[model samples]
Target: MSLLHRIEHPRDALAWEGDMPTLGRYTAGIAGEKFFRAIQEHGQFLGTVCPICEIVYVPPRLYCEQCFEHLDEWIEISPIGWVHTFTLVHLDLDGNPLPEPLPLAFIQLDGADGGLVHFLDEIDPEQIFVGMPVEAVFKDPAERKGSILDIAYFRPV
Candidate 1:
C-alpha cells in the first residue's frame, strides 16, 4: 500500500512529505536575492514599479503581470504599510501545532500599489486591524542569509 494510504488525514500526509527535506538553505533567484539583499544589507525595502501602469509591485519582480513588460527599476518602499488581511496560524506548515500561535498578515505598503504577505510580531492578535500601520523588521546586517526570512517580521512602526 502507498504510504499516503496509511495516513488518516490528507493534510497530515502532505505535511509529512513536505518535512522529508528539512536540513538545507534554499537559494533564492537573482531577483529575489536583490529584493532581500536590499532589505538586509541596506535596511531598504524595495519593489518593482511598473513603468507602464505606474504601479509599484511589492515582493519585487523582474516582470509586471499587468504590463507584460520587464521591470528594471528598483524603488525604495516605505516600511510603513497598512494591514489588509490577517490570520492566526495555530499550527506550523508541518501540521504540528505550535506552542503559541503566529499571526501572518498581508500588508499594503505605503507608496506601493500592492501588498506583501509576511509574519507580524510584537502585537496582540486582538489588536491587529485592517489598517494598522506596520514596518518591516530586518535582520542584523552581519547575520543576513540573502533570503526573505532575512526580514525577521513586520511590527508596529
Candidate 2:
C-alpha cells in the first residue's frame, strides 16, 4: 500500500493528518546499561574516563563526543554530589498544592564530569541551596530494577 497521498497543489499538502499511536521499547545502550546495572546491584556509581579529554562521564557513554574515542576506563565514583541548582515544587503531578514544597536539584557528582537531576528529600526547602552536599538513597538490592529510579532520591548528607 502506498503511504503517501498524492498532492497536486501546495495547499492540499497542508491538511494531511494521520494517527501514529506509538508503543515502543527502548534499551539504554551499552554504556547506560552498565551504569544502571552497577547502581542496581552494587549501590555504586560508575563513570567512564576519556583520557584525551581528561574527563569522566557518569551514566557513562561508550564513546567520547569530542574525539570519538571508545571509552573503556571505568571507575567507581562517589554517589555523593553537591547540588548545582535547585527548585521548590509546590504542586503535585495532579496539579494539587502539596502540603510542603518538594525540593529537587541537579546534582554534580563528585569526581565525575556528569550529574543527575533528581529529587531532594529530608531537607527543608528553605535550607536547600546551591552547593549543598547530598547523597543518594537506593532501594533495597532485591527491589532494584536497573534504572535511575533505583536511587530513590538524593537527601542532604
Candidate 3:
C-alpha cells in the first residue's frame, strides 16, 4: 500500500491542494560558494584541474571522475572562449513567447577542458555560430552577488 493512503489524518494530503503556499531555501555549499566568490570578489574565472587526467573543469569540482581522486588544484582560466554549441529560444519556460529571442551557448573556455553554459548577448540569433569567439561581461563589482549571474552575460569578443 502507498504510504500516503495510510495517513492517520486525510487533511495531511489536502495541504498539497489548490496552489498551496511553500517556503523554500537553499545553500550552494562549499564548491559552488568558492567558485562564485572568485567571480564576485576578483572578477576572475577559475577551474579545477584533475591531477590524474589533467582535465580542467570550470565551475570547479571537488573531485575527478576518471581516476576518482579529489581535485585540489585551482587554476585561473581566461574568460574568453568559443561557442561550442548554441540554441535560440523564442519562448519562456511557461511557453510564452519572449519579447525577443535569446541565444544560449555552451562556451569552451581557452586552456580548460570543460566549459560554461550561459546566455549570449549583443548579437542576433541568426548570426551566432559554432566557434564564435566570446568573452565574459561581469556586473559592476558593487552590484555582484556570489553567483554565476555575477557574469551579466557573454558577448562576442
Candidate 4:
C-alpha cells in the first residue's frame, strides 16, 4: 500500500472534542523551557547535542539517550532541510473537510541527524516533493510567544 493510503483522517465530532478529562495541560521541562525562552526572547533555534555521541536533538534535551549522560550544551540548528515525508490534510478532525487544504511535512532539519514534524505553508500540494528544501518561518518578534507556534511554519527555500 502507498504511504498516503496509510494516512487516516478523523471523521467524527468526538475526535474534535477537547473535553476529555484525560487531556493534559501544557508543562515545560527544563530544556523545553530554555527552548521556548530563546524563541520568545532571541528568535533563535537551539538544539541539544550530545558531546559524547554527537547526536543533535532539536527542541533541546536534558540528557543524551544514546550515551546515557546529562547534556548541558546547546547547538543552533539550520532552518533548512529536506522533506522526509508529508501529507495533505483535508479535514479538521470533526470529519468536515477544511475550506482550504494544508500540507504537513516531516522535515529532516539540516545539521541535525533527525527531523521534526511541522506544517508547511505557502505551497501547493503538487509542488511538494520528498527531498525539497525548506526553511523555517518565524513569527514577528513582537508577536512571538514562548511556544512552538512562534515558528509559524516551514516554507520552501
**Top model by TM-score, which number?**
2
lDDT of each: 0.84, 0.92, 0.89, 0.86
Over all chains combined, what TM-score does candidate 3 have? 0.83
Which 10 residues in a row give candidate 2 its minimum summed lDDT? Answer: 1-10
Tens digits of per-residue lDDT, candidate 3, 95-138, equal: 99999988999999999988889999998788999999999999
In terms of lDDT, which candidate is strongest?
2
Query: Per-residue lDDT of 1-157 in model 2, one digit per residue for the tens?
Result: 2668576697966677689999899998999999998998899999999999998998799999999999999999998999999998999999999998888889999999989999998877888889999999998999999988899999999
Error in Å for residue 84 of model 1: 0.6
Model 4 whole-model lDDT (C-alpha atoms): 0.86
lDDT of 1 by residue, 1-157 (tens): 7876676767865554334656886665656778877877798888888889898888788888887899999888888898999999999889999988889999899999887899999998889988899998888888887667777899987
TM-score of each: 0.76, 0.84, 0.83, 0.82
Which lDDT value does model 4 have at 157? 90
Better of 1 and 4 by TM-score: 4
Best-to-worst lDDT order: 2, 3, 4, 1
Candidate 2 global TM-score: 0.84
Residue 21 accuracy (lDDT) in model 4? 69
